[model samples]
Target: MHDGAVDLKAEARARIYAQPIEMLDPAQPELFATDAMWPIFERLRAEDPVHWVEAPDYGGYWSITGWNDIMAVDSNHQTFSSADGITLQSLESKAETARRGARPSFISMDPPRHDEQRKTVSPVVAPSNLTVMAPVIRERAGQILDGLPIGEEFDWVEHVSKELTAMTLATLFDFPQEERRLLPHWSDMITNAPGHGPVESWEHKRREIDAMVARFTQMWNDRVNAPPAGDLISMLAHGESTRNMDKAEYAGNLGLLIIGGNDTTRNTISGSVYALNKNPGQYRRLREDPSLIPSMVSETIRWQTPLAHMARTATADCELGGKTIKAGDRVVMWYVSGNRDASMVEDPDSYLIERARPRQHMSFGFGIHRCVGNRLAELQLTIIWEEIMKRFPSIDLVAEPDRTHSIFVKGYESLPVMIPSRN
Candidate 1:
C-alpha cells in the first residue's frame, strides 16, 4: 500500500469504530481506494443494517447493508425506483451532466421503456449468442496471454485486464481492432470525476466525452445508412425500439453499455489474480482441478463485488428493515456489503473456489435491473483462466494494486505482476 494512503486508511478505520453509530459513513471514495471500507460495512451489518447518512453535498442517502434488505429494495421496483439515477451522484453532478445535454440511460429508466431498450441489445448476450461468442473469446484470450512477457514485472491491469477488455468491447461494437484501447479509455473517463480515477479535471473529462460523442455519432450515421449487422451500434441503429432515439438518449445508452462492458469484467480479471495470489492454497487447488475454473469465477465476482452499489429513489413511502422510507429518498443497495453478509453466504470473506453453490450471491444484482451481460462476463473469466492454467504455472503479484478512488467502481487502476517462465 502507498504509505500516505495507508495512513489515511488506518485513521479512517480507527475513526469509524470510535465515532457514534449514526455518524458512521462508508461512502467515502478514499476508504474504497485504500481497501478500508470492510470494517465499516461489518459494523453496519451488525449494528444498523439500514443506516442513513446526512451528507448534503454527496446527496444524503440511506444505505441498505444487509442481504435481505438489499434484495427487498432491488426487487420491489414499484417502491424503489431507478429513474432518478443508478449510483449516488451529487445533485450538482446531475445538473452539470444535464447542462451538457446528457440523458438517462436505460439503467436509469423505469418499466416499459427500460424493458424495451434493454431487450434491443440483449440478443448479443443470449444463450445462443454466447455459444457463438465462446470460441471467439477463447481465441482472443489465448492471443492476449501468448503476448505476455515472461520473467518481467508488468502492470497486469494495463497489459492483460484492460487489453482483453478493450478487445472484447471492440468486437462487440465492431470498432477498429488496432484502436480498441479507446473503449476502456472512454469508460474510465465516464466513470470518474475530476481528480479521481483516470480523469484529471472537468475540462479533461469534457474533452474526452466530446471526442466520444463525435466518433460515435459518425458511426451511427454510417450504420444507419447501411444494412443492419451484428454489432451493438448497428443494433441500436436498426432495432425497432432504439431506431428513433434522439441524440442525447443515444449517448446515454452508449455510456451505459461502454462502462458496463468495460469495468465489471476488467476489474474481476485483476481481482481474480490478486485473490489467488493472496490465497495460495486455493490457487493450488485450482491448479489441481481445472474444472474449478467456473466455480472460481463466480466466487471471485462475489469476493470482488465490482460496481459496489446501485442507487434507487423511493417512489412511495415504504417500510424496510423496520425503517420508514419517505418518497423520493435516495436508497443505495450496497451490493458489496450484501455479497459478504454472513447471514446469507457461508464464510463470505474467504476466497473459496469449490463451494457448493458459488453463484448464490448478489454480485450481478437482482430483479429487473440485474446485470444483462452477466453470462458473457462469466464466459470471459472462465476462458481466460482456462487459458492461463494451460500456459503458465503462476503469475505472481509483485506489488499491491492501485485501487480506483471511487466508491461506485470497485476496481484497480494498476496491478503489478510477473509471469516467471511460461510452461
Candidate 2:
C-alpha cells in the first residue's frame, strides 16, 4: 500500500511538473497525507513564489511558498486578518462551522481583542513556569521511557508520544489524569476531515464537539466556583477577560488550548523517531553526544512542519513576492514549504541534528500570534530525548507509519517500533 501510494505520487508529480505554471493547484490534501507535496512545493518556490492555486473543491487561494514571503504575511497581521479563518478548507465548511456554533478564539481575532484574551493563559507557559516544570517533565519522561516494552514492537505514537503529551496537557489543565486521552481525541475530532480517521461524517464530528464543549463547560463551572489556581481551566475561569466569554467563545478557546497543547508537540515526538531512523548518521551523532538533543528537537520540528499551513484573508490589496493580492483573497502561508526552501535553509531536505542555527525555522510561526506553548513543546521534546538516551540503546522502526489524512495537521496515526534493551 505504501509503495502504491508512492508510485501514484510519482505519477502525480510528473503530471504536475509538466503542467504550465498557471495550471498548478497545490491545495489538495492527498499531497500532504502521502508525503508527496515536496516536489509541488519545490516547483512553486522556484517558479512562482506567490502561486495562485484554483482547486475544484476549495476554490482559488494564494499559496505563499517562500520563507521570506511567509514571514511577511505572518508578521503583517493587520493586512491579513486571521478572523476570516485559517485553513484552505472549502467556504461551505466555514459556513458549517458557524452553523454548528463554533466560536472564534483569540487566534482568529485581530489585535486588541486577540492580545486581551491571549494574556489570560500566557503565564502558564511562561519561561518562569517552564523552568519550574522542567524537572517534573524530565521525571515523567523517565517514567514513560522506563515502561516501554524492551525488544518488542509497539505503537510508539500511542505508548510514548501521545502518552507523554497527554500527561503534560493534563498537568497544564489540572484535568483528571485518567481522562487525559480525551484531550487529544477532541483535538483529532476538531481537525479531522469528514470520512477520515475517527470522523465518519459532519454530524459525527459535531456530536463529538458538542460533548467536548459540555465536558469543558462543566469543568469551567467547577473551576469558577473554587479558589483561583494555575491550571488553564482555572486561569480562564478566574481571568478578568476570559471569565465572561460566551459559550461559543469558551468552546473555541478550549479547542485552541487543546490543539496547541496536543498536536504540535505530539507529532514532533513521533517525527523525531522517524527522522532519526531515516538519518542514521544524525542518530549516531546524537548517540555520541547527547548534548545535541536540543538541536535535534528543533531540527525535527523543522523537518516535520507539524501544522502544514495557516490561512489568512487579505484585509487590503497588497503586493507580495512579485504578486498583487487583492482584498479578501485567501492567502495561505505553507510553513511546510518554507521549512524546506533551499534558499533559506542549508540542505533543507536533510535532517541534521547539528545545524548551526537549528532554531531558525518557522514551525511555531511569528510575531504576536506566535504559539503560546512553544517553550513547553520544546522542553518536552528535549526531556524525552534525554530520558530515551539514558534508557534504550536504540529504537528501531518496524514499519512505515500510518499518517493522518489531513493537510492542516501533519501527524502520524501510528508508528510501530521496537526498543533494544540496554545491557
Candidate 3:
C-alpha cells in the first residue's frame, strides 16, 4: 500500500489516465515501426481501445485503438472534428507563437463550411469521373512497364511506383509532365513524419511547402485567364466555388491533392511488389488467375494501410469506452489497429487475396473522410499489376526492404526488386 495511493488497480488506471499523449514526432519515421509500438497497439486494442498518449512536447491526444472505436469516432464527426487539423497538430499549432496562418482546406474544416468546401471538388472525384480517367491511367502504366530495366536491379519505389503515380496525377491535374516531380517533393515536405526523413524542423519545411503553395497561386491565376478543358485545375479555376477560393485555400487544396495522390497510391504499388515477392503462395495465386488483381489490390491496402492514422479534435467533453475525453482534446483514429481487429477481420494478420468480403478493410478510411481518390488508387494498382503480369510472371525482391518509420503514411523507403526480362 503506497502512501496516498488508491487501490492498485485504481492507481494503475489513474496513472494511465493521467499520462500525457505520446507525441509521434513528424521528424522521425522509425517511432511507428518499433517492435515496442506494435505490441503496445495489440494490448491497447485488447484492453484499452481508447488509450491516452502522454506527449508533453507535442501535447497530448487520445489514441482510438480498435476497429469499432475508430469507426465510432469517424462516423460522429460532429464530436470528433477535423477542422482543427488532420494530424495531431496543424502547421499553425506546431509553429512558434510568432508564426501561424489560417487553415488551408476542407480536409480540416467542419460542418456547413466543410460541406460547402467539399462540394466544390466532389464531382471531379466521383465514380463516373474515375471511369473516364481509367484509360489514361492504364496507358501510362503500360509505358512505365515498357521502360523498366530488363534484367537489372532497380528501385521499384522510385522508378515504377513514384513515377507512375506522379505522371498519372499530373495527367489528372493537367500539369506539365516535366514538373511532375515537384508533386512528390512538396508532399514529402508537407507530411514529413517527424524523425522519418531529412526534414529537421517543421517551420523550415512549412516555408518550403508555402512556397509550393505560391506556385499553385500562379497556376490558379494563369488558369483563370485561360483554363484548360477536362482538367481539375481548369474546373477549379472556372467553377463556381473553387473559383472563389482565396489564394491560400486554393493552394492548400492543391497541396492536399498532390499529397493524397502521390504518396498513398505510389506506396501501395511499391508495397504490393514487396508483398508478392515475400508471399510466394499468394503471389502464385494472383499470377495464375489475373482476375485476382482487384482482390490483390484490396489485400495490399490492408497489409500496408498507408496513412496509418488521422486525428480529430473533440468538440465537447464526453465519455468513450468508460473514459472521459475533454473538449478540444485531440483524438487519433488508428486505422492500422482497426484493420487488424480480430472481430472485424478473420485471421487479421494473414494476407489473403481471396479473402471473403475483401473490400472491408479501413485502408481508405470510413464514413465522410473516406478517400475521394479511392477508385483512382484502385485503378492505378490494378493497372500496374496487369502490366506486371503481362511483362514478367515473377518479381524477386533482392534487398531486405525497409519501411518508413511513420505513424502515418506506411510504406517502403527502399524496395529493390529483380524483374526478369522477357527480352
Candidate 4:
C-alpha cells in the first residue's frame, strides 16, 4: 500500500510482535517537549523498553527509548546497522542510502569501514585537539559577542550561535569564510524533513545536493592536487585510507562532515540561550560562576538533544526488551527521549547548571557512533558562554523563540535577544 493509505499502527504491530505500540503523530511537535510520551517511556523502561512506534505521515518503525536499549542498538553494529541510515522511517532510510550510495560516510557505515574512516579523523576531534581549538574558539566567541549591537533586538540563531559554529566549521575545513555559510544551507537542503525549512521539493533538494557535491568535488580535486598544511579537507585528501575514496564516497563523507559538525553545535548554542532566558536563576548562576560553563553546556545539550533519534536497520533477527524484531526492521533510538530518561537522570526537568553528571548526556550519542566532534562542540560552547558572560554580564530573551520543525534535529530556528552593552 502507498503511504497515505497504509495503517501505521497495524504495520507497526506486524513488524514487532510485542505490546501494541502507538506511532508518534508528527502533527504534534509539542509531544516532544510536553513529556507526553515520557510516561510511556518510563513504563516501557520498567516493562517493555523496546517499544514500536507506528506513526502516520512518515513510515512506521520501532522506537527504542531506554538507555540500555539505546546503547544496545548503538553499540551492536553487527545486529543493528547504520548503513541503512540514521533517522526515523523507512522512506528516509531508503532515500538517504540511495543519495549517499557508495559515498557513504562513517555515519552510514558498519564495522571495519566505519572504524577505519572514524579513526582517520578521531585524533583531530579528540580532547587534545579541542584544547588546541579552545582559545581559537574563545577568541571567535569574544569577537561575535563584541560585535553584537547593544540594546537592539537581533536573531541570535543567525548572529551569535549559528555564525560562530559556521565560522569554526569553516576554519576547520579551511573553506573560505564567505563561502562556508553555504555549508549550513546545503546541510539543511539535504536533511530538512518535509514541511520544514527551505527544502520544499524533492527535485530541488536533489539538485541542491548535486550542487553541493559538485562544490566538494572541485575542492577535493584541488586538495588532492595541492594539499594544504593540516585542515580537515587536507587530511581527508591526503590520508592513506581516504585518499583513494571514490567520488560518491568522497562527496557523501564531505556532506556528512558538514552536517555532523555544524547542526548540533549551532542548535545547542541557540537552545542554550533560550534555556537560560527562560530560567533566569540558572542564567544568573552561570554568569556569576563562569567556571560552570562546561556543566552548563552539557546541560544545554541534554536539554536540547539536538541530534534527536538515529535510526538503525536490524541486520539479524533479534529480541530486545521482550520485543521480537525481524531482520531489516527499522529501529530508531530516540536520543531526545533517552536523554530525559528519569531513571538515568535526576529530576530530568530542572535545568540546573551545576548538575554533577555533566557529560552524561546522550546528545553526542553513545558507543561507536558517539559524536567525533563532541570536544570541539563543547570547547566552542564554553568559549561562547564565557565570552557572553564576560562581555555583557547579562542577556535576556526579547520574544518567544522559533523552533525548527524536524523530528531528527531539535533546535530553535529563530531566537531574538537583547545583550546590553558592557561599554
After TM-score superposition, the amount by which residue 128's alpha carbon in candidate 4 deviates from its true location, in angstroms, is: 4.1
lDDT of 1: 0.91
Which parts of model 2 have CA positions greater than 4 angstroms off?
1-6
User: Candidate 1 has what TM-score?
Assistant: 0.97
Q: After the best TM-score superposition of candidate 4, give how far the Cα of residue 402 lies from its true spot, in angstroms.
A: 1.4
Per-residue CA lDDT of model 1 for 1-423, tens digit only, reads 458867877887788899898887778887888898988999999999998899655767899999999999999888899888899986667777776865678999988999999999998889998898899889999999999999999999999999887888888899999999999999999998888767888789889988997899999999999999989999999988899999888988989999889999999999999999999999999999999999999999999999999999999888888888999999999999999999999999999999999999998999999999999999999999999999999999998999998879999999999999888
Clashes of each: 0, 0, 24, 5
TM-score of each: 0.97, 0.97, 0.88, 0.88
Q: Name the top lDDT candidate.
A: 1
Clashing pairs in 2: none
Which runs in model 1 stand beyond 4 Å of their true positions?
A: 1-11
Cα lDDT tens digits, model 4, 46-129, are: 555676656664565777878878988888888999987676643553565576454568788887888888887676676777
lDDT of candidate 3 over 1-423, digit per residue (tens): 233323543544444445443422222234444312454456677777887766544567788878888888988888988877787653334664236565477787777776766676667777888888888878888888888886799998888888998898888777789999878878777666445454667667767777887787777778889945667777778877567888767766877788788889988998898788768899999978999999999988987788888989999998898899999999988888889899999998788899988889888887777787888898889988888888886878887666676667787777888877652
User: Which 10 successive residues of model 4 have the least lDDT summed?
Assistant: 26-35
Ranking by TM-score: 2, 1, 3, 4
Judge candidate 4 at residue 412 and give its lDDT: 73
Give lDDT: candidate 1, residue 239: 88
> Which ten contiguous residues of candidate 2 have the minimum total lDDT?
85-94
* Global fold similarity of model 3 (TM-score): 0.88
